[model samples]
Structures are given as C-alpha cells and as structure tokens.
Target chain A: MAGSELTNIKSPRVKAARRLTKRAFRDRDRSFLAEGPQAVREALALDGVVVELFATAEAETRHADLVAAATAAGVPLLRASGEVMAELAQTVTPQGLLAVCRFVHVPLETAVTPGSTLVAVLAHVRDPGNAGTVLRTADAAGADAVVFTDASVDPYNGKCVRASAGSLFHLPVTTGAGAGRVAQHLKDSGLRVLAADGAGELTLDDVDLSGPTAWIFGNEAWGLPEDILALADEVVRVPIHGRAESLNLATAAAVCLYASARSQRTAPAGVRRPAPAG
Target chain B: MAGSELTNIKSPRVKAARRLTKRAFRDRDRSFLAEGPQAVREALALDGVVVELFATAEAETRHADLVAAATAAGVPLLRASGEVMAELAQTVTPQGLLAVCRFVHVPLETAVTPGSTLVAVLAHVRDPGNAGTVLRTADAAGADAVVFTDASVDPYNGKCVRASAGSLFHLPVTTGAGAGRVAQHLKDSGLRVLAADGAGELTLDDVDLSGPTAWIFGNEAWGLPEDILALADEVVRVPIHGRAESLNLATAAAVCLYASARSQRTAPAGVRRPAPAG
Candidate 1:
C-alpha cells in the first residue's frame, strides 16, 4: 500500500478536490474538505457526512484504523502520493489525510429545540479562526446549537474547521440566517437572547443566566451593530478589571457560554470527565 | 516635520529596528519595537517606556495627538517615508508608526504583590498569538499580574505584541521565570495556585476560586507536563459539556480569570465602564 499509488497531481479527482478550497466551489458541490487525521476521524464518525477519504500511503499505514473505518462505512478511500495530498490540503504542510464531507448544517428550526439550555449565535463575525474557536467553545459549554449568521465567516472555511479542533462535528450548526432572524428564532424556541456587547447595559456579574438562553457574539473589532443589540432580551458586557479596552471575541464567548453552563449544570449532556480514581 | 524627511531604509536606525524582530537581538538591546499607533500611544502613556517614535507623513497628520504626547514626554520622533516604515514594520501592510521601547517585565516579587487577587501564569504556552490573547484576557479579567514562564513564548514576540491589542502595556508582566518558581512565588504571596490541565483532578464547577488565585496554563498542544502540574496546589479542568475535546488556551485562560474576577469583585481596578449613564 505504501508504494503502490502513483503521484498524480493533475488527475481529475485531485483537481475536483482542489476546487473545494474555495467557498463558491464548496457550496456548489455541497461538500468541503476536512484535513488531518483528527478531522477525518470526526467526519468518519458522523453518519453519511463523509463522502470519501484520501490519505498518503505512509499515512494509510499509520492510520489503518481510519482507513478501516472508512471501508466499513462503505466510503471509498483513495491512496494518493504526498504530492497529490499537498494539492488537496489547504495547510502549508499537509498532514497526509483528508476527508471530503457533505455540509452538516441543520436548519435553525431543527438546531434549537425547546429543551435547549444554551446556544451560541455568532452574528456578523468575520474571522474564520475566531468563528471556529467560538464554535469549539460553545460545544465545550454544551450549547445545544451554534448559528453562523449571514455576515459570519463560513463554517466550512478551512482555517475555521481546523481551529474548531474536531468540534465542527460535535454540535448542531445552523447557518445562513441573519442576526435578527436568528435572535427571533432563538426567542421563538423559548430562549432568552442576550447580546454580548462592549456597551451593554449590564455586566456579566450583574446578570442572571440560569435559564434557557442564547448569546449573540459579533465581529472581532466592531461588536454587534445597534439593530442586532436591540433584538436581544438584554445586552451584557464581560466586566474588564484592567486598562484593556475589551476582551477578544472568542474569549468573550467562552466566558459567557461557561457562565451559562455553570448556572445550568446540565449533567447528561456531558462534562469534561474527571481523572479516574486511584 | 513630515514630508521634509527622506526615508532611509538602509540607515542605522531602520536596520537596527529590523534586527529587533529576533528575540536574541531584542534581549541584547533590552528593547523591542511597538508598531502601530495604538501600541505607540499606549507606550507613550508610560514614563520611560517609549525611547523613540517613527512615522510617515500621512500617519503623522492622522495621529497628531500621538505626536503631541511624544513631544510632551520628550521622546525622540523620526519621520520616515512609506518605504522606511515598511522596512521596520512586521506586518504585511505597515500601519505607519513604530516605537522602540525598553523591556517592560517586572520581577516575580514586583508583579504579584501581596494583595493581588488574581494572576495568570502561562507556563509553557508556545503560540505567540495564544500567549498574547491570554495576556489581554488576563488584563480584561482584572488580573493582578501575568507571568510568562521559561518555556513560554517571549511576550516581546511581534505577533504577541500585536495580538495583545495594547493590553501588553496595561498590566504587569513577569517573564523568563520557571513555572515552579512562579508557583512558589504566588503561594508565598498567600495565593492558591491552580494549574489548568485537561487531566486536571477537579473541574472548575467543583472548585472554589473566590480568594486570591493564580491560574497556570500550559502549552497549547501537550498541556502542562507532570512536574509543573505537581507544583500547583490543585489542577482544575474547565468542564467540556459537549463532545468537544477541549477549550483553546486563550479561551480557557479567559474563563478561569473571569471566574476569579467575578468571585473577587475588585471595585477599584476599573471594570469596562458601563454606558456612561446614557
């Protein structure tokens, strides 16, 4: 397996995979690439999400389990040379394994159920890394859903997917809705919508968040616009105790989501497991 | 004051500034360049921090207040052409201002005072962006001090300084110390030391952080090594309520620091101000 596959950077399959790097092509095909063993494994774990798997011969040997899993799931595995993998990979250094997966976003109605305790709505967020980070943070906080608003960076962006650290598959993600529409949807789902803005009326310490809630986080530089802030049930700011002007967007999201997670303490959803007893 | 000055990209000043990009050179000169108007302005706010300032004609006109500040502080001002500004700048597009400033780290004893309620220890964090964001988050959370241990990235790293968004000048930062020594220093200062590791024994929810607390965070990838974790009074994990594996380093730092800030509720340090009684 290590020496069999010939290098073919110009192959049609490779060319097709290469096109997914752009958002337009990814949208047209309704598919995107998940690079590295971690993301490939996560993609394989989800039902019908993974369309195909690609790995270098060396990687195929090193990650036989992923190859085996793909085979078991009836997903075809393509063994490519390092050169081909380099072509398929978006990173400067390709990790030798990548998966082309179907878009996994659910509709807003399906993303947030009535029993949802917390949700993170990324509205007007432009940075892919920040968007992905907040997605990971939301999943860690056990938010029921994460919404990427129309103005937000595509969840399928390569950098965002990598920054998510396999969290792209962990929780429900709803996309393409506007901030006001997402807020309304969350409100309709019986969740209190709170906008996290620097000019918010109340500080995080002064707010009560123990109920079903949705947090709206905005762009990294200019926070939520006035119209989006107006739709929220309340606007809250994370208190700043030093001379720093503001908190980073993802950091702010983590603080808000965890505060809600702390207050809610929903057990069955999952918590970071404790160390095994001695 | 502006257009009259010719750009000398090969001049001793520009070449010397360029060399400061490397840590060895920065340490040798006991100085680093703070680029952009925001950073330069913050550096000017501190006495003896700003040694000299460089600007292009356009930027000088745009930020006359900064020029006034530097003039009032008696700091040398150098006008340069766009080419010279680009030569000294680390970013792809130069922001047209740069300040060569002295190292700002304090000793462990000076950084974490007796009455300090919250502190952040970045033990072996290697990513400059993560380190810088954590520093900014620590500042926003009203942390008393932020420490960059021996294995940590240099706070003077160009990316770290920019990522800090001027919070680098807002708080006390102690650098080049080992994690264990820093831990001992915090313990001796009457603060409880908690190391944040994925394998941490107690979850944040199960712990009490209301008192004087110092949080130790490790490398982005491998987390804290065992020897360093053993040095902490306790190892705490932020709960991951969903299927996500872990939180990002900067995000974890934010949650932990803000938790302490909320519990401690120090009034005089200045919270991000409320909307000015509008």
Candidate 2:
C-alpha cells in the first residue's frame, strides 16, 4: 500500500477529499462528509464507519489516537496540508480534520420494535435541518423510531446528517413512500396515532401518551397535511401560552416527544398492553 | 396629505423602505423587519407593534381587512412593488408584505416578576436562533422571564426575531451585564438555581424543579463557565440514551424547562412553592 503524503494540490488523495463539496461526489461515490472533532469522533466510534479519513499534518499529530483507530480498522488515510484540509472541509473552521464516511442505509421495516411505546412520524418536512433535529430529539427522548413520510427532506442530506450529531447512526429511522400507510399500520397494530397541530383539539398535556404510539410532526411551513390528520386517532397540540404564533418545527417536535416520554414514565408500568392477537 | 398612489420606483417612501436592509436604519428608525401574513397577524395582535406597514398593491388588496386595521391603529402605510418588497425581506420567497415594527425594550427588573416561580437566565449564548428559541420555549413552558447576562446574540436580531415567531412580543426578556450577580440574587431571593451540564451529577428528571427557581442555560460551544457553575445550587442533566454527544442548546432548554413545568404540575397543590416573593 502506498503511504502517500499529499503535499501538492494535484495529489489524487487531496482531489478526492475536495469532491465532497458536491452532492454528486457524495452520492455516486457512496461517501459523505463529516467535520469537526466531535463529529469525526462519532464517525470513528461507529462500526463500518470510515472509508477514507483526511487530516492535516498537525491534526494527525494531535489526534494520533483517532488516526490509529481508523488505521487499525483498515480505513485508508489521507494526509493533506492545512490549506488543503480547509479547502476540503465544509465548516468555516475545520479543526484541520475530516472524514469521508461510507453511508449505511437504515432499514425501514422493524425500525420500531413492537413493544416500543412511542415513535415520531415526520410528514412532508422539507427542511433537512428540521428533519434531522427531530431525529436527534427522538433519540434523546428514547423514542423507538423516526419515520419520514413522503415529500420529506432526505435524512442523508449533508446539513441533516450534521444536525443529527450522529444520532442518525443510533436511531431506527425509516424513510420512503407511504408514511400514511405506516401510520395506518401502527394504528392497526394498536399504537395510538397522535398528530401535532397548533389548532389541535387537545393540548399535548391533555393527551394519553402512555400506550404504544406514534406522534406526527409536519412541515415547518404548512403544519400537517389533511390526510395525515385524518389518519390520526387524536390530534394534540403544544400549548402556546405566549405571543409566538408557532414554535419552530424542531422545537415543537422536541417538546412533544419529551412530553410523551415523560407521560409514559409517569404512567403505571402494567399499562402497556400485550400485542393484539396476531 | 397627498392622495397620489405611491407607485413610482424612486418615491421617497419606497427608498426609505429599501434602506431597512442596513441595521442602522432598523435601529436609528426604532423599527425592525417583519413579513408575511402570519407574522403580520401575530405582530398586529400584540400591543406596541407596527410603526410602519408596507405592502404591494396586490397584498393591500388581498388583505384589505389587515390594511384597514393597521391604518386604524395609526400605523404609517407604504405601498411598494414585489421587487421593492424583496429588498427589505430576509427570506428567499418574499411575501409581498412587510412591516417596520417599533422595538420594545423590556426592563430586566420588570421582566423578573415579583413572585415568579420559574425563569431562565441565559449566559453568553451567541447564536441568534438559539437565543430566540430559548425565549420562545421559556414562554411556552410558562417561565417568568429570560435573562441574558454577558455577551450574547441580540435577542431582537432579525433571525432571532423571526425564530421567536411572535414570542418576542409577549415574553419578558432583559439583556445586560451582571448575570452571575443577578443569579446569586435570585438564589438569595429563595429561588433554586439549576445549571444544566452534560456531565452533571444529577439527572434533570431526578431534580426537584417544583420550587421557585431560575434555570441557567449557557453557550453552546463551551457549556456553562466554571464561575457560573459555582453559583448553581444544583447541576442537572438530561440523561442521553443514544450516541448523540449533546442536544442542541434550544432543545436542551426546552427539555429542562418542560421537566420543571411537568414536576410543578404533578406536585400536590399545597406542596408546590408559591410565586417568588419580592
């Protein structure tokens, strides 16, 4: 194996790192961007994470343990100059290190365990940042899964990936067609489907979230679609006690998911029902 | 008072509106930016809003009732073209409507209600979006005030303003120096000060948040400073069940504030602390 030190701009290793700026390179090459020490650490910690790791000479010396772990995992390493590293990096201050991680597809089915008490379904959420933050919150609240419905932002978008803070790797997330179908399936499977809306009939505090359930968060611009709302057994809302017309979409999702998690915690343990006669 | 329609490209009114893109214009004029029908409705609903209301001819016609209300409230009105409106708009899709609102200065002393049971003291949070969302969440969770100590984003920055939805209007927020001194004062006034940290000894859910209290949220990059942490009677954290390193600053604030609110709700009516005593 060639232990190439990429000193020049034209080096093939340096050129490959620069391609991460474009989506085509990220998709066609099946490699994506991860920046900053914390993010790089997260990517390193995950199994099957590194395809190619890049760092400036200074970062290589400073984060020797990190580089060693990647090398031990049989990952290819690229050393670039600080200037080159900065050019290849996404964030303003790159910390002189980055990684091109192989994207792992999260499974759609079985993402939510049958015994899980709460799941979050995002429908037509266009903003990747909002979608990713919701996924992170769901992970924080220990929700079983996050389901992305039709027309939603791709969870794999760079901004979304960064926003998830690697929670994307931890949570069971299902993205694809027919989120409505999944909602129906959860309902038929005996999970309560609660849709979140500003004009919802019941406040989130007023809803019973102790049972197996799915909470739906909709588009930041439009709130939930009528079809999704119709599928909901009950509609719940985060009470707006102040003059803010609406909370940001991500904030709203965090509050609802946390509230549901709290509700479940406070409820009697035996309240969870057995799976409805298969 | 000339009745001539204000349609010309170089009209003084149109030129003045265009100047709002400069912060000095926004400040010196004692007016800031607001747009879209929804934002306008919330602003109009709030007291002490809208010094000047600007809209395209079509917007004025489409929202005649709103226009009438603005005129009745003695707000100055300007008519501009869609192209002209975009000059003052922050978003990509200009709503063909905008409002120049008077900046409301909330006094810190007044914001700290005489007998409030809970509030949030933000220390050195620099992100405008994070700061504004914190204020909005504090409002939703029914906290008395959001206090900023030391260097932090201006709570009224356009991005912060937009992020707050209309919460900026309703919530009592005061910013200035001596946050630590004020926090100590809060403790002396019989309020518990809970500081959130990633490695805190106590879990947020385990803390007794039902008492009169002021929760402090710190900068996103460094968490709370040691000096500020020293003032906290209790340091608590939201236990992370996933691999994500930490929750977003606003999301963390919401979770903490809501947990406190939840405990207050579940407490025996008599056991909960009375409003803070002056």
Candidate 3:
C-alpha cells in the first residue's frame, strides 16, 4: 500500500529511514539504504529483501520506471517531501530515490565453497571508497565472490555503496571473516591464497593463474601485515615496469583480478595444468 | 634559503599559497599546490618549477629527507605553523606539507611527438578524481604522455592532484587540446587512435594493440559523442563478460591501457604487425 505523503521530517517512517544512515541502526534492523535511481532500481530487481522504498514527488515522476517496478512487485512505496528525502540521504545532492534493503551478503562458507574459481579478499582495507571499488571490480572480472576481513572497512557504509555503483547487488559478498580463518578455508577447499604485496619475491607475470585462486589485498596505506602475509600460500607483486611507485589498492586489485580472469578463461577445459612454482 | 616561521595566516606568502586553492588563481599564476610528503618530494626532484615549499615543525622533523632535498636544491623552505598549513591545504586532514609548483604540462605537439609510443586522451571527462586516476594509470602503464581535452577537468585541481598520487610528476601531460585535433595529430604521427565506447563494434580482446596507439576515453556520464567516436580510427569496447552495467571511467581506462602495455611488451622486437583493419 502507498503510504500517505510523509511531509514531516520527524515522521516515524522518515525517522526510521534516517536512522539507517548509522551503522548501529543498520545492524540492528539488518537493513541498509541504497540511494539513487541506479542503486534503487538494482535493489528492486534482486531476490533479496527490499523492505520499503521512499521517493519525493519529483522522483516519482523522474524515476517512473522504478516506481512502476515497486508497485508491480507489491512492495510498500512511500511518497516523501524533499526535506524528508534529504534527511534520509547521506550525500549532499540526493538522487531523489532511496530503498531500504536487507543485508544481502552470504556466509563465507557459501562464498568460498567448492567450484568457486576466483575470489577477492580484502584485509584491513580501511578506505571505504577503495573497498567498494574493489568489490565492483571483482564483480566485473566475474569473480565468484568477495570477502572482507574483520579489519576492513564496512562494505555497507554509505560511501562504499555509492562507490560500488550497483555491482554490490550483482554478486555475493562475505564480510567480517578473520584473515587467518579465510586463508585456511580457501586452502582446505584447494584454492591458493595469493597475497598482493609490493615487496613479494614473485611477480604477477611469473605466477601461473590457471588454478583456482583467492587474491588477498591489504590496507591502502600499510598494505598486508607480516602475520597476514604468512597466512597466504604465496605472495605476489604486480610488475612495476614504469617509474610509478605503486598502484593504489583498487587499481592493483583490478589488474590482478583481470589477469586471473584472462588466464582462467583461456586455459583448456578439464586439464589442470600446474601453476609455475614461485 | 629557509624563510622565517610563518605563524600569521594572513601573511602575503601564506595568503598567496591559500589562493592557489582557487582555479582562477592557479591559472593566472601558472602554479598549483602539491601537498603531502610524496607529492612534495616528487616536485622537488623534477625539472619543473618549485616556487616555494612550506612545512610545519612536525613535518620538518618527520620529513627530514625532503627538507634536505629542498636545501640542496637552493629552494626556499618556509616553516609554517599548523594553522597556516591547514589553511593552505584543501584536504580536511592536512598532510603538514605543501609545495607551489609551476604548471609542467607540455603542448600537444610536444606530448605526442614522433617517438611517442603510447598515449591516453580523455575527451570531455568532467570528474576531477576520474581524470586524476586515469593519469596515474596511464603513467603506470608507461604511456609516453596523457592529453586532456578542453572539456575535461583541470589537471591542476587539488582533488585531481591528490588522486594522481605522485604520477602527475612522473611523465609529460598536456591539457586544453580539442578531441579532433588530438585524433588527427596522433594519426599523423603514425599512432592509431582508438576510442573506448560501450557500443563499439570492435571488442578490446579482438583488437591488436602491438603498435603505437592513442586511446581516447569519454565523459563519465555521456560517453564519447558520435562525432568524437567517428574521429578515431576504430571504436573499441572492453569485453564485459560479467553482469556489470558498465565499467567506470577509471577502471575501464586501466583495463584498456594495461592491455596495450601487455601487447606492446610481448610483440617481437623490430616487427611491426599491422593492426586488424577497422
């Protein structure tokens, strides 16, 4: 049912949606805000839970397709005032539409189970933008899943969601797993956990990526710690042929994931070629 | 020479540095601000003009190497108060160091001269962060130069500089070129002009990138216009094997440039294989 126009900024529904901006409130409710037309549209199409959607009259007209989709799905759609929409939005320029979506991340066991050929693991990645970009890149590279260690930034953060640009809804993401636990789970499952480090002895060009692999990237500033590095089966560095000091976390992850994706795609079917020894 | 401690934010030197935060001031003075130890250190090492340097006491102690470099270069290094540094920095968390660097961009003719091998041209790219990230990627790929069309964001923007990390100093950059002129100049210089478009007929995987090439990328929102796409020798799109709606400006550019870099590196020496006919 369509709710009455929510004019008051402090109305119960508006306030509830606004509270989702806080991590604690999102965790308690198991919901996060997916703002903008692109994100809201994607969330509405997913099989995951989309509790409610809010839009201003302007948005109702501008995003008529999304509104039609919500109505077709029999989901509750609320008409809100500009002030209420702004109050619910984290960005300075709100995109007029926002959806309250339940956490869609799967368990680590489900994400890294057998037959998962490629995965991305972020360890202590503090920047929300970098974390989100990595998720988007991994999805584009067709990685089976992405995992975030407990030390990493919250994937559900508003900025992180914005950076993902709708890819967050396209793939399964597992979060809050311990670095060591993830390494062990992947290894036991027969996947090689390769840590991306600048000082690694093995270069990416020299490493064979034909086998199942889990790429572990680290914090934006400090990169992977020694303890975390020790947990991986191998450590590899992207070759720096130019004078650039190093690639940032997101770009580095993109190159590494794409490399693996290309290798896996071109490898002959049913022939398990051994990876070159580091 | 070390200037006296600049405690007063209103002092002429400090005020001039602060004004550099504005585009008008930067363009008028032909100077831009390079902040943080990494950028400042790079600027000091380059042949580009370093008009002045400023650091807080904490930064002086923390970045003793930079101080010594400036001292050896015979450049004036002013000691400023934290207040002064903060006022001069655009970032919320100032890095305690800043450098006034004269514009180092070359002309289009100079950037894409006869011997140039690989280059990236951005056509009407509006986002400063995207433009900066592309510049860094191009540098890392060992592209000879990067050219920004007049419609693109200013390379000297503080946000753009920060996104480039230290790459803005690593290679020659050119700005204010028209898309048509860049396409023609590159073509005349024996470089193939390839435009990256989502709707392109040619896939990046199928195209041969073994020769000198100039890659043309478009705006973040509306991609290259039909006229701009027609100007190129061929229009190519990165194959999206996954369900991503589309790659962002930066990630797409990285994939394309790295593809070229890899191809050029692997091609046999002294053999110029003709690219597939567009």
Best by DockQ: 1
Clashing pairs in 3: none
Model 1 lDDT per residue over B6-96, tens place: 4777888788888999999999999998999889988998899998888888888899999888978888788989998888899998888
TM-scores, one per candidate: 0.94, 0.86, 0.94
Per residue, candidate 1 scores C-alpha lDDT tens digits across A32-63 of 99999999999898999999888888888899
Model 2 lDDT tens row, B88-156: 678898777788777665666677754767788888788888987888888888887778785676665
lDDT of each: 0.87, 0.77, 0.87
The C-alpha stretches of model 2 lying farther than 4 A from their native spots are A1-31, A80-88, A184-190, A266-268, A275-278, B1-31, B35-40, B45-49, B81-87, B184-190, B276-278
Clashing pairs in 2: A244-B167, B115-B276
CA deviation > 4 Å runs, candidate 1: A1-6, A266-278, B1-6, B266-278
Candidate 2 chain B lDDT trough over 10 residues, lowest sum: B1-10
What is candidate 3's lDDT per residue for A52-148, written digit by digit as tens? 8998988999989889988888778999888888898988999889999999888998988767888999899999988889888888888888998
In the range A1-278, model 2's lDDT, one tens digit per residue, is 21656777767777886786676787688777777666677788888877778888788889888888888888888887777776777667778778888775555557755566788888888888888888888888888888887668777676787788877777677777587688867866667888888879898778777778788888877888898889898888887665556777888888888877776776897886555765
Deviation in angstroms for B116 in model 1? 1.4
Ranking by TM-score: 3, 1, 2
